[model samples]
Target: MEFRHLGRSGLIISEIAYGNWLTHGSQVEQETATACIRAALDAGITTFDTADVYAETRAETVLGQGLKGERRAGLELLTKVYFPAGPGRNDRGLSRKHIMESIDGSLRRLQTDYIDLYQAHRYDHSTPLEETMDAFADVVRSGKALYIGVSEWTAEQIRAAHALARELHIPLVSNQPQYSALWRVIEAEVVPASEELGLGQVVWSPIAQGVLTGKYLPGARLPASTRARDDKGGAASVARWLRNDVLERVQQLKPLAAEAGLSLAQLAVAWVLQNSNVSAAIIGASRPEQVTENVKAAGVKLDAGLLKRMDEILTPVAMFDPAITAEASPQTRP
Candidate 1:
């Protein structure tokens, strides 16, 4: 696997990171999740990503058990906060109480004394940015977390946080965003802003949650066991991309993928890595073979002509608005 420094930081991580978002401890059986993680390790992946709110808090525990025997010093493990983890009114957001409690909970569940990177899953509009950064600065000072990052944060939020992180003498190294050939929301503003702030992107869903794999045919019924068929939230999340126009356009890219000697999934993952500011692309897997198939994109480079053709085919249906990064409606937590 090829490694890249996360932003301007001295940390080097695998270009293809193994992530367990919807799969571990929820979608698949424990055995299947463990096998997928083992396959990633066999392929030389040194980075793993998870979040505290995934599966209502079971994903992290499953990941910890999966990595029980591995050499912890050889891996870069990451997790996130800022979402509700319980029914209590103070169970969520980036408040000092939440951050302090959440880090301890994560350490216990993840079976690790320290987290390589701890991210704010989303911007907390209810709290001051300084309060959140201050809590994170304490995390770093205590050596519970090595670096800080934010996900789906707008350019303005990133700039503000970066300034605070610098003042606090903490390392804010990366941003995790949903970036792919079809979803270029970060390109117009976030990329440029991150470049200026020395933050590299560790992108998620490079295949658009399986939409870019050409498996969901435009006119066909949703494939059984596929993400689109999942009744538990995953289907609802990807419903917008299930449109016939988007599916048809995705199908047109299959021949181009063949010409480049790649699976449609591999082509999609490699396309995201083409950007110099993207340090890694996080890929989720349900089966071991899926992990093996995606690792092929690690060092592959797509030619300029192919990339141009891909844009020409997909631009009509692409979502590139900078507003896509805006904060969501505040949740009514307990």
Candidate 2:
């Protein structure tokens, strides 16, 4: 596995990160999750990503158990905040109280003393960015987390946070965004903003949530036990990309992958890694073999011609609107 420095930070992470978003704690059995984690380790994946809100907080526990006996120093463990982890009014957002409490809970559940990277899952329009950044700075000073990041944040939000992060002497090193051949929403503004700020991207769903893998064919039956069938929520997330036209277009890439000697999945994953600013691509799996297959994208460079052809094939259906990254307006309290 090839490694890259996260942004300008000194921390080096595997190019293929093992992520348990919809798999652990909800979709897969614990044993399956453990085996997948083991498979990732066997494939030389040292970076792991999860979130406090995933599976209502059970994902972290499952990941902690999966990583049991692994040397902590050798792994780059990451998790997120800014989602509702509980029912109480104080249980969510990037508020200082919630951030302070959530860090301890995540640390406890993750079975780790320090999080390699702690990210804001989404921009908290309700909370002052300063309060959030201050809380993150505190997390760094307290040694509960080593670095800070934000996922799905707009370029404007990122710039504002980076300003504060610099003022506070906190290292905001990475941005975790849903980036793939089908989803190019981050490329226009977020990538340039992050590049200017020295932040690298740890992209998720490089396969467009299996759409780019060509498993969900146009007008075909939804395969049993696939992500679209097993994860209604995830299926909904990928539903837009599941249109007949998109699926038919995706099928055209099979020959390209064949020419490159890569599976459709590997092509999708490698496509994201081709971006110089992308530090890693997070891949989720329910089985160990899936992990093994996807990680092969690591350190594999696609030919320039093949990449150009891929763009020609996917550009018409690709969503590159910068507006997709716009932050939602602040929700008013009643």
Candidate 3:
């Protein structure tokens, strides 16, 4: 597996990070989840990303079990906060209370004392940014987490946080955002800001939640057992890319994938890694073979011309508006 330094930080992580978002502890059985994690490790993936809120905190336990025998020093484990992990008013957001309590809970669930990179799952409009960053600083100082990051944060939010992170002398090294060939919202604003601030992007949904895999054909009935048919949150997460227009446009990339000698999914994953600022592309899987297949994109380099053709085909349907980044975060805590 190819490895890159996460942002300007000294920490090196695998380019292909295996993430359990909708699969582990929810859509797939624990056995399947562990098998996928093993597959990722077999394929040389050392980075694992999860969240405390995934499957209401069960995902971390499953992941912890999956990594039981592995040397902790060899893996880069990442998780997030700021989502409602519990029912109480004090159970969520980036407030000092929640951050302090949540870190201990995550450490317990993850079966690790120190998270490699702990992130804010989303921006908390209700909490002061200073309170959040200060809490993160304490988490680092306490040695519960090595570095801190934020997910789906706007460029301005990132800039403000980076200034505070510098002031606090903590390593705020990465930004986790939804990025893929179909989702280019981060390119216009977030990328530039993060690049300037010494932050790298560990992008999620590099295949647009399987839309870029060409599995959902235009006008076709929802494929049996596919993400679109999932009753779980997967369906809603991938709903925007299931439109006929988007599906039809996605189909045009088949020949390009063939020419590049890559599966549609590999093409999609590699497309994101082509950006210099992207440190890693997060891929989630229910099956072990899927993990093996997608990891091939790790060190694959796509020519500039092939990338251009992909853009021409997908640009019309792609969501590139910079405003979309800000829109992605909730105005108030959920």
Across 1-334, the per-residue lDDT of candidate 1 in tens digits comes to 9999999999999999999999998998678999999999999999999999989889999999999989999999999998989889899998999999999999999999999999998888888889999999999999999999999899988999999999999999999999999899999999999999999999999999899988999999997888888877488868989999999999999999999999999999999999999999999999999999999999999999999999999999999998878843253322
Model 2: per-residue Cα lDDT over 259-310, one tens digit each = 9889999999999999999999999998899999999999998989999999
Which RMSD values do the candidates have, in order? 1.2, 1.5, 0.8
Which numbered prediction scores highest in TM-score against the true structure?
3
Q: How many backbone clashes does candidate 3 have?
A: 0
Error of 3 at 38 (Å): 0.5
> Where does model 3 exceed 4 Å of error?
none
TM-score of 3: 0.99
C-alpha TM-scores of all predictions: 0.98, 0.97, 0.99
Inter-residue clash pairs, candidate 3: none
Over the full model, what C-alpha lDDT does candidate 1 score relative to the true structure? 0.93
Provide backbone clash counts, one per model. Answer: 1, 0, 0
Report the lDDT tens digits of candidate 3 across residue range 64-85.
Answer: 9999989999999999998999
What is the clash count of model 2? 0
